[model samples]
Target: MASYRGAPYIAEQLQSILKELGANDEVVIVDDASPDNTIEVIRSITDPRIRLIESPQNRGYVRSFEAAVAASRGEYIFLSDQDDVWIPGRVAAMVVALESARVVASNFEMLGGGPRPWIPRLLPAWDRKPIANLLGVMIGYRAYYGCGMAFRRDMVPVFTPIPSYVHESHDLWLAICGNLSRSITHLEKSTLLRRLHDSNETPAGFRSLGRIIAARVMLARLILEARRRLKR
Candidate 1:
């Protein structure tokens, strides 16, 4: 998990994580030079399994997540947002989901917010649904949210050095890479409560023409990579 000024919900998020994690599993938190008490709240947690990595400068969310995953030693990594709350049995369910595929994206509900955004409606059926066209799914309802997803450690290296052209979302890039190279499955169950408030650091919403063109180019490359992976 990567945090910046997440003092308000980081404690609650960490507590839920600690409750769900197994004895050997650990939670790694990356602080991107937050101006608030996010780091202090992380330190207050007395769990040996919780590891905190502090960034000297604000490296943004993508870099922070890549760094955190790189520092982790788990075979499978479950990404989480600092403000979300994981439901009971989330870890176990994702672990089981990871047994068949490298990446697993699931459904989630928003709380204390107006409406849930990016709720997948027109996508493939969600019964461990294997998304063959990663970019195509993204065009409609791109519900590849990190809070409701878990991926294999191998996926880290596949998309780690994220290109600036498609750097808008690490989760999107990772989902595309996983679907193209390995395997990606979507579950129907909601695993977490996504807390949306005025202070959230959501990326810019309006899509410009340049972004559309860039995405088209990126999709072509992903298609080529998918074909190459299929032969190998």
Candidate 2:
């Protein structure tokens, strides 16, 4: 988990993750210099499976994720935000789904103690697509949230240390890899209760048309780079 100033909900998130962890499983929380009590709350949880690492400087969400996942020793890695509530069976369900695939994504509900409806206006994404089609789907619309994503360590070569200029974070890279493997699976059950609030890094919807277009262009560049890396 990569966190920044998540004091209010970090404790709850930690508790939920800890409950689902198995005897051999471990939870690693990497703090990106939150400038808040998020670290304190994480330390308060006295679980041997839970390990906390503090970065010397704040590197934003993308770098934080890279750092956390790189340090983890798990064969499979689950990424979560600092402020969401995950339901039970998340780890087990994903593990089962991943048995025959390289990666798996679960459904999640948007929340913040109320209902808010708004999606990106520029491009509509497919619920499911072939690995070849996933690049376009991701460029046009959002599919996986960081919290709802999990991948095997074998994917580290492609997903990690995400290119510096990509428009988004590692989530997109992971999605691209999932599609490339032609084994992406989506669980219909909602295991994540995603809380939306003022502090969210991403807004509920597109903020401007120019921003959207710029994002698409950046994503196009990312796809080009990915092809070169994948030798496609």
lDDT of 2 by residue, 7-62 (tens): 99989988989898888888887898988888888888899998888998987788
Best by TM-score: 2
Task: Return the TM-score for each candidate structure.
Answer: 0.86, 0.88
Model 2 TM-score, 2 decimals: 0.88
C-alpha displacement of 42 in model 1, angstroms?
1.0
lDDT per residue (tens digit) for residues 1-232 in model 1 = 9999999899998998899988898999889999988999999989999999999999788888888888889998999999999888888888888898888887777765456775453233543343534545546355577778788886666666565455546677767776765577677777888897777765546788897777667766655654554455
lDDT of 1: 0.76
> How many times do residue backbones clash in model 1?
0
List per-prediction Cα lDDT, in the order shown. 0.76, 0.75
Residue 19 Cα positional deviation in candidate 1, in Å, after optimal superposition: 0.6
Which lDDT value does model 2 have at 108?
A: 77
How well does candidate 2 match the true structure, expressed as C-alpha RMSD? 3.3
